[model samples]
Target chain A: MTDQATADLWPGERTEAARRLLLAAVESFARRGYHATTTRDIATGAGMSPAALYIHYPSKAALLSEISRTGHRATLDLVEGAEAASGEPVEQMRRLVEEFTAWHARGHTVGRIVNNELHALPEDAFAEVAELRIRIEDTVRRIIEKGVARGEFEVPDSRTAARAVTSLGIDVARWYTDRSTESPEELGRRYGVLVLRMLGSAAA
Target chain B: MTDQATADLWPGERTEAARRLLLAAVESFARRGYHATTTRDIATGAGMSPAALYIHYPSKAALLSEISRTGHRATLDLVEGAEAASGEPVEQMRRLVEEFTAWHARGHTVGRIVNNELHALPEDAFAEVAELRIRIEDTVRRIIEKGVARGEFEVPDSRTAARAVTSLGIDVARWYTDRSTESPEELGRRYGVLVLRMLGSAAA
Candidate 1:
């Protein structure tokens, strides 16, 4: 229940019941979307009555907001961790794309909800989620800026390049499936090079 | 009440009432998403009673299906039209990216519903919409294949490269705003160059 990978993917602690609820919410939200998914649906999916959901979460919006905040923080942490892992900008970009793309492909259920369902969150929740998003953007931008500063990468605009690179992974959640011909690791490898090339990396 | 651009953006001829309902549906779906938006909301948005909506479209799902089909067809036409406008593979890629990106930015409301709200579509309706999506993929893949053949582009995998290039524009619908400093044309121009860079075009 507490594997290293699962522990790393989700940022905060949760009880077994709370974990079940969040997992149910991810499936329902990814399947039916935030606006359409009800707490009853999430509760039933988790094998509990509708009333049981409110004991752990205030509303359906609370469930979605928690998921959004957790996913965003995890994403930001992945990239920021990559930035500190090495001083080489090229390696940093490669690891960043690989981990990010794989996360989106393998955890598409969470990825889909995190990226596509933002508008459904309440205003305050959205702001909290958005702050993490901006930090993710800034972290990617800093990686590009570092490469540019070292004359290692050639991008027209670091900010736009960062956006495109981020979009590359986010869109993977939209199309990737269990039956996809390319495995998550394979996609991560291909995208790693493709993104480096987009950065105008001569090495790519 | 129909403008030339609106007529061009939406395929087929629609009655004024039908057009009103569709336009209203786009606004509602783009704002609240399909599952959250009711037929009454669409009807009210169009200044018609709920019953009046049924006269034009059979159900809420029907309105969404129409919008999804129209938008997917419109997108396919834009890309195919670009392919025919030039014989040069590089030029073909450039125009394809420019027009496709601009359409997503300028026509984002429709684009958002078409891409994001597919699950709300019934199975048969989703199948029809998906066929157009596959064709859009093929069209982009063909552009890359032609460029690779003509020595105008360098890509590791044409299919994956097509997905990335297409994703570059599709994600624009998710983030573009009236407050965005870059206009549709500007985003299109920047994206065209970035896509060319992904293709490894010497010019880029």
Candidate 2:
């Protein structure tokens, strides 16, 4: 579970058994929240005992921190992934929103835990997560900047527009799912319209 | 306080004192969040013993419900106040964003508690707050609709843009004031520009 490669992303053992344990932590954290969940519960959710679970991850907080770190990294990566696309700023934003919204819907627990118990982390840990978040924000701002230079979009302040786009996607963690009134694909399509128009995109 | 008169937004008296008590609840809930805060801390923060606090508001959950209700009502009132002004949709949007941003910045704990612990409310209480929120959202949507009808703005979906505006303002609560880097008015003005642009206002 602690493999730094995926350890930072939260898949245990690379083996099936530890992967089950890691997945269990997601369910436990989602339902009970980070502060309320326990190693024992995660173990039981994986059909094991607390002591056995400890062999995979040192403690409950450790498991949470790893999962949260992984989730945050994934979000940053998703936005960065959009940079490879060659298109107008509006098209880039549409792609970013698609990846951003879908990840939160699929990786529900990690996103929820990171957002909810951010205060639980030690100051240094909090700074790490905060830095990761800022990088993502800056990336969005750069995209807006690129769009402005291309005359593909216009914003009063690229920074504030970036924040709006980021918040629009992040808020999905608070409300999104298959059972939700709006499906992930539908949300992506609608958000594409919303975000594109926010940048003065007539075609979007 | 407890005064519901539209003219007397902030009552002064024991009932007005209830507003203070409720504000205390907002601070407690925002700091520790809804699931983590105890009613005792709320009472003590209000300068009353926990037992005395209970006499005014039955439980932590009840306190959360009241603050959320009041917060939503205050938001609706602000929008209504701006709607009464005779102006183009762009002007109306600017004023609404200015006031809404100030309100969110002024009472961040109220915003945080409302957005974060919304699920903690009892069914009936949740329904009440939810209805109030929907009403506020609908009010914003109406402005968008009117603007679209007047050909003053063009949005793919008025409802989606309304949701974007709310999300943008509410985010002020999550990360506002915590950083001493920007004044409330400055943040409000910057966000106002962003929101107006998001609403498809060329003036933004």
Candidate 3:
């Protein structure tokens, strides 16, 4: 909407330059927030002209689209890859919670932007992001279903339980920070215990 | 910073007008998010001039600060009022979960905005808001500790159990909507059952 939208600012940059631009945008977006972060701010943060941002992406929306897409993909891979953790369904669930929560706590910018600002994305992009989320959610549902069948867990409404687990992990993106006393590993382990109890299983 | 810094905005003429402005701000902040929402957007949504909005509030920050303070106060009141809902500690805990979840579902805009944007406020405002939150959290913690002491329930750690209970209820604001098949009351009751089970008690 502004003159020469951020999308058109840069074409392609040096690999390091693009990486810096991405990191700068991440910090700015996390610090001030998405809609408030201008291409100029991100470009300046990367020590480039606003016009240079276009070398890597087409628009500010493009920047957000990429971050969200990438973050969701990473999250989905963790859940789907839980299937490959080489453990019982319950242990797989534990590993899933640990990996998921830690990623969110460390990947604050991208994860929070993805989870909190879904309503901000343009239509086609939102659909892509939502589909990725559904896959991750379905992963939780399947894990719970398997646990129930194996008699490792007892719970009512696996779908709701799945929702609870996913929601708990997602909220870490909203609130958890390194400034807190609890380390990511410790916090995730504690959350895993509560999550397992919620599912009516043995201690995590 | 704007000339609209008058006390008239607090709660004067045409109470519905102020109410409408407040509600519209909530929607704008939730839909577009706190950082993205501007006075112009909110004023436009309420069919008022930007100057008219000033007559109602000093600045955009004031609007958000007021909303957050009121929302936190409302939450504190809810928790304190629900402290003695039934004869038994377990029943009281169930009522707390049911009420809190239902409150989050019904008041998603306020809860979401307060939870997500509290950091945007200045230090004094932030401290005030944090105090209210700690109070509510302690109330939940005390309730669980008391329940354990009374032998109505058992928990691994009363503090951890409190966090799980609050997190489950708080998550309702992020996910539960009227669009879902389960009504707020239904979700509240179902979540209450899980909370009881996690506390080592039978479902109420």
Top candidate (DockQ):
1
Best by TM-score: 1
lDDT of 3 by residue, B37-92 (tens): 99998898778999999998777777788878877887787787778666667777
lDDT of each: 0.84, 0.73, 0.76
TM-score of 3: 0.89
lDDT of 2 at A98: 80
Q: Between 1 and 3, whose TM-score is larger?
A: 1
Error of 3 at B187 (Å): 1.0
- Model 1 lDDT, residue A5, Cα: 30
Best lDDT among the predictions, by candidate number: 1
lDDT of 1 by residue, B1-204 (tens): 222333465445788899889888887887787888999999999999999999999999998888888888888999999999999888988999999998888876677778888878988899999999999989899989998998888888998899988988998877776667777887888888888887888877
Docking outcome class, model 2: acceptable
* Residue lDDT tens for model 3, A1-204: 111112222335437778668667776777778888899999998899988899887777877877677678778988888767855888888889888877766665566667777876888889999999899999898999999998988777888788888887888777766576666777777777777777888654
Which pairs of residues collide in model 1? none
Candidate 1 lDDT, A1-204, residue by residue in tens:
222332345445677778888888887887777888888999998899988888999998898888888888888889998888988999998999999998888877787777888877899999999899888889889989989998888877777888888988888888787878998888998898888888888878
Error of 3 at A122 (Å): 2.9
Sort all candidates by lDDT, best to worst.
1, 3, 2
The window of 10 residues in a row where model 2 chain B has the poorest summed lDDT is B1-10
